[model samples]
Target: MTADARPSLAALSAPLVARLIDDAPALRLGIERVGGARVVDAGIRHPGGLEAGRRIAELCMGGLGRATLGAVPGTAAWPFGVTVHSAQPVLACLASQYAGWSLSHGDFFALGSGPGRALARQEALFDELGYTNAADNAAFVLEVDKPPPAELVAHIASTCAIAPDNLTLVLTPTQSLAGTVQVVARVLEVALHKVHALGFPLDRVVDGIGMAPLPPPGGGFLTAMGRTNDAILYGGTVQLHVTGPDVEAEELANRLPSSASRDHGRPFAEVFAAVKGDFYAIDSMLFSPARVTVTALDSGHSFHAGTLAPELVERSFTHVP
Candidate 1:
């Protein structure tokens, strides 16, 4: 399909953003205005919880996907889990939810995600996908402990060619309940990202489903970030449906899981600290789900790889003191 034929991601996600604002009180989200731009505080000063995270996860996908929280058997203390699926997996996961845009001002830095990115097209990924969009309004999700500065907000609006009043930003801290859920909710996005990095044809990706055990929010930022990343690296699972030859599907499955990286086995925080927090020093292949299944649609066969490291998951989630 041609890029021009695609739906406007900003337009698709507008209603979800509006609904989040309208239901801010019930969701325990703080609705505030920053320099004429609307800010939805999912964790900062408010006690945003699971439901809010679920909704925010969908918003992160630009309304092109569904995120549901549930409990599966055999999870022990961490029984709760998050499942996400998208029919437009490529566009929803990579185009909108990938957290690929970098935004910074002074001491504050954030990677911007959600439908608003489709409008800005700031990253080269957009060009590779041959996708561009326009909208009167834009919505973004920033994994931040506080709202962005006015200058950064203004720059975002100008870049998207939208008014500040038409802009909405959602703030989520990694140590908060809402923040943990939303970040762990990126299980499917993590898979798609790995697939892209593997040089698989994005157009062949038809559908995807991903689930990960949700850990309790950690006591500090480092612990929280570790839990989130470990949730995917050790406890996450993904199944992708694609149109391709069986051999290609098998190859993709073999190469797609977190275990494919030499940096696997250890908790992500340890890995980060080992590299002195230089994310670039770590293996790029380490950012995938624990287990993966890729189904070749035309041939009706599925290939699987990797294993769930519940031992590591338990150690990571419970040992933080």
Candidate 2:
């Protein structure tokens, strides 16, 4: 859930984190079906891609009360499949829970064929990874740079055509299909660690951060987040409260009247001016858990924690994220 609300940094161990990157196919890791035929024609030359799709389906089914992984007696799926609820944490734990798929990294690419348009889109997807076409799969995995929705849909479409009446899409409130949530958390944890080591104040660190949870085209909860910590990356004047950019303060101020317009260094400056002192107390309702009171913490900001993942619109990365 929220690495932020975590009481101590001790929860993160180097070895535990390292275990997430294994090149194995995680079968029966609790997938819920969003709704689809038993035989989906996911078009992918890469086994990894296909497996990813299958995992999504399993998770979706689990959410719909249609199926599950374990062999529990009297389970809805019966002898073939059990039943699971669509939950983000369940999806996130898929890989870790499965250790016997025995699928190899290279074998992953051989599962399905890529259509012409899909191959073309792969170019852009690969580009998003900041890699040239020459980059191997092994090299590409070094970073988690997923393609945007348009490209991703085209890629999936080219790989496997969903059958008629199979258009259902289920999701876990805890996560998304885009695999964004899990990856983003890892990134944040790293940044969090670095900032903590440097003795950066928690509020200051969280202030500049922005988050966006991307929906999964597949059935699993693959939430993603996009952030703008550029201010910290470069030697900017304002130590951004978080990685998120605050140049939109005026706009945000206008949009959220109840909250102070604390974009980047601007709001802090205002607080400093009002207080006429070195330390200023700055609080804001700039972020909201839209479902409940404001935007979700997963949409951006760690106020809600991971367990409380709240859905956010695309614009969340700007203000609410």
Candidate 3:
């Protein structure tokens, strides 16, 4: 399809919404009417269970990718992993999966992602891609422990140019099973964001696939957050197929991994605590997959950077002594 003819992510993902709603009872994802908006509590205020978390992870990709549970090699404590693959990686990952926007109101905050971002068009990254969608309905994923207020829902509807009833909000907390699965599912997204940050043209990226281990659940918010971040920073691996100049693709591959950051040696939780829990204080470059491989489709040349830190992965996943 031509760039201008591309469908809105929200429109493209509507089927997944219907599927989730239809399987709501089985998935343990509770759906309810809140302020005329349809709210799916995947984790917050609901167990969301494991199946729901897996489905939500897929939904976060705007239904453009598949997210399934698998095993990460050499990891016994948190052996399960979230695997993601997508033909529309740019649209599904960077434009949809990456939580690039912070949605906040008085005493309320959530990192917003999913197809709703395309409708909001508030991020500067959207402008750079020349991508926007005019969908009559919208879907958003919020990582928070509490349901949003009615006013917040109304504000989202207005921003998306849709009626409150036409909006869908999926909520998941970082401490929950669903939240952890969805966050680790960002392996491909994290890689794309790093490449974009390094000034690579995203349109050249034709496909992406990635995998990162899912840590066992039990810890509270901070610990869960740490393990999820560690999963990507220490265990994740991403491969992108691009139809671009060989030199540029090689350069991107060289600079794309998390090890490229000076803060690569320690567990992410330690790094977080070192910054006194101020997320912004940590180096932005530290947020990426452990290994990245970029292949130039035109020249059949490939380049790789970084290596998986299984020791740190063990420390973070198991909290071992």
Candidate 4:
């Protein structure tokens, strides 16, 4: 946590780090430059950036065309481009966790200060097939854009050489934020899911979406997958939170899990800490699953894609060399 301090990977939150494999097509990565050096709003303005959900899903499932396209009108560009000196810290940290998934030249901020370029190779194949996964993908816009025009969408699809159906548009605002930063945050979250759902097998498509309006189990907002108790993308920043036993409770007990020991990873304690965590983790790990798992643990409980709150879960760590 110091200028001269160098932390190992284990010191970093697992959800906060990710990797992009060259072979996996289901995980198309999308990144756009924004206004801030640190936490500035620099999303794709022109042609906007790739839809987060769409690009990643395309990368994961395959059968999609090129992952990104555009520079079209109304989409704002980072005129001054990115400030590397300003973003050096996050850039370094993100590069470490997401090195493989990142563009070859460096971070998206690198894309600015010049014409845009696809950082990753254009055409690659996956070696694992089904296990194909993606890590460290991010898309950020200062102010969200509306869905591009039809022609623009077609052009983007053409640029990527994919059909219109295969594409999901990044949104823009015709109006103003009106102090509606919270709404922007919620929409950003929903956008991550809807687009990702496009790549799911037909039977699994239901898992790809949900707004937060409907009352969730126990009337909660954080529903699983596409189901939620409230309309997401509302008028406030939405913070995704999770904390559980690192290893299964049973497994922990077998070791030092004496019932008398303290719950170092209590959900309440973790949630309280999460409440204070900055957008650093909020932006990158909200939708990511590495830190927590989602399982439809109960078959009888019908989830229009229902999710079991990770709070009910526990974890155990095993050392392996």
Candidate 5:
């Protein structure tokens, strides 16, 4: 698609939101009219179902593709999986899925991700991607235990240059089922971010697909956080189709997995504790899928990296033998 013909993320996702509201009102994923803004609560007040989680994951992709619930090939404790596919992988994953914004107001804070980030244009990554979008409406996904307040919603509206009524926010806490699914759904985003961090030209990436085990929910925040992180760090895998030089594709493939980091080979929870809960203190390269494959569309050559650490995944997931 040409630059001018590409649809705004919000525009592309609005229909999906409407479908959710209409099809599964019982899921309680609806538009909240607060302070003249609309907030879509996926997990906060209501118990967001697996289907809602799937839709929220798709929303995170800016509706560029789909995220479906399934199972990994050979896993027991972490059998559930979220499979993602997108034609515009760079635009859908990096431009929309990577949670790059830290939003806070008073005591409320959440890492904002989704179509709303494009509308806000608050990160330099957008500039580097040569992408900017504007829409009368905006949408955001927030990983938070509580719903955002009216003031925070208004602040987001102002940043997006949209009226409060034109904004939509989706909330999910790390400990919730929906939250776990959505985070695991970020397998592709994690791999793409790793490639970008390695200085790979993202424009060469034509398509992407990823899958990571969906962790069972019920633990407190930190435990749940660890399991989700381990789902990607130990069990996730991604395959990216790229139209780039074969050498560059090989380099990206080598560097695209979590094992490339010094921080690899441990449960992410242990690493988090070792860093004293300071996320920045840990190696940034640790946040990636367990395995990655880069296919050079031009040369018909493929490069693979890393290996799935199912032992670590079992260790982190449960105590059962």
Candidate 6:
């Protein structure tokens, strides 16, 4: 697909951004102007909760998807969960929601995710997806405790070819309520990312749905990050509909789970610590949903792989002491 033929993620998500700003008080999100950009505080100063995160997750997908809170059937310890679905999985999950754009300046560092990323085209992934956006406004989701520096904000606006005031920066802290939900909400995105990493043809993916148990917010950053990761690595499930040969769909199902990674057996925090906190050192394959089902749309055959590890999820969620 050509970049010109794709839908503008920023344009599609504009209504979501407006809804977020309009419902800021009810959602407990703090709205302010920082570095001339509209910053939506999902957790930093506001008491943003699960609903706020759910909405933010939709925004993260450029409003091409839906995220809902629900119960995890057959689960007791962790009953709450988030389910996500996207019809345009490649554009929504990869081009917008994947957190592919890395932004940093001084000691401040953040991975920018959302519709604005389509406008900037900073990451090489956009090239693979053959997508670009032309919009008057852009919105970005940054998982951080503090506002971005003025220089960094200016850089983001400049790269997106928009004025600072036309930019919206959403901050979601790792240890906050909104943070945990938003992070876990990436279950489908994780599966889509793993599919890309496995060299599967992105154009074959037609639709996808994923869900993961929502763990309680951890007391600190490390613990919080671990629980969120474990939720997907152990407790998550994904189903992808694709137009492809049954054998290819089967192979994709087999390779698209966290269990296929060399770094799979333990909690992510342990893996992180073993790697000395070097994210690059960890196995890229370990960041996928625990279980997956790939259905070949043309053949009407479904292939399944991996299993949920409730024990590991329980261990990670309870290890916060």
Model 4 segments beyond 4 Å from truth? 1-158, 162-171, 174-209, 213-298, 302-321
**What TM-score against the true fold does each predicted structure earn?**
0.98, 0.21, 0.96, 0.22, 0.95, 0.98
Q: Write the per-residue lDDT of candidate 3 for residues 1-321, one digit (tens) a residue.
A: 576876668877888888988998887778888789999988766687767777887788888889989787645666779899999998898788878778888999988899888888889988887788888888888988888888889988999899999999999888789888888888898888887888788888899999999887636888888889999999999999998699888888888899889888899889999999898888888889998899999999999998988899988877832
Which whole-number lDDT from 0 to 100 does residue 116 have in model 5?
84
Clashes of each: 0, 58, 0, 54, 0, 0
Question: Model 4 scores what on Cα lDDT?
Answer: 0.22
* C-alpha lDDT (0 to 100) for residue 67 of candidate 2: 18
Error of 3 at 307 (Å): 0.8
Clash number for candidate 3: 0
Top-lDDT candidate index? 1
Tell how far residue 115 is off in model 3, in angstroms.
0.3
Better candidate by TM-score, 3 or 6: 6
Write model 2 residue lDDT over 1-321, tens digit each, in one string. 343332211122112212212322242122222122112212221123323333433332122111123332221211211122222221111111111112123212211111111112233322322212110011011112221133333333333343322221112122232222222222222223333333433333333222222222222212122221111111111112232333332222223221222432222223344555434253333222111111222334322211111212212222321
lDDT of predicted model 5: 0.86
lDDT of 4 by residue, 73-116 (tens): 11122111100111111212121211122111112111110000
lDDT of the candidates, in the order given: 0.93, 0.23, 0.86, 0.22, 0.86, 0.92
- Pull out the clashing pairs in model 1: none
Off by over 4 Å in 3: 74-77
- List, residue by residue over 101-135, the lDDT tens digit for candidate 5: 88998999888999889989899998898788988
lDDT of 1 by residue, 59-167 (tens): 9999999999998433576888999999999999999999999999999899999999999999999989998887899999999998899999999999999999999
State the lDDT at 13 in candidate 1.
94
Better of 2 and 4 by lDDT: 2
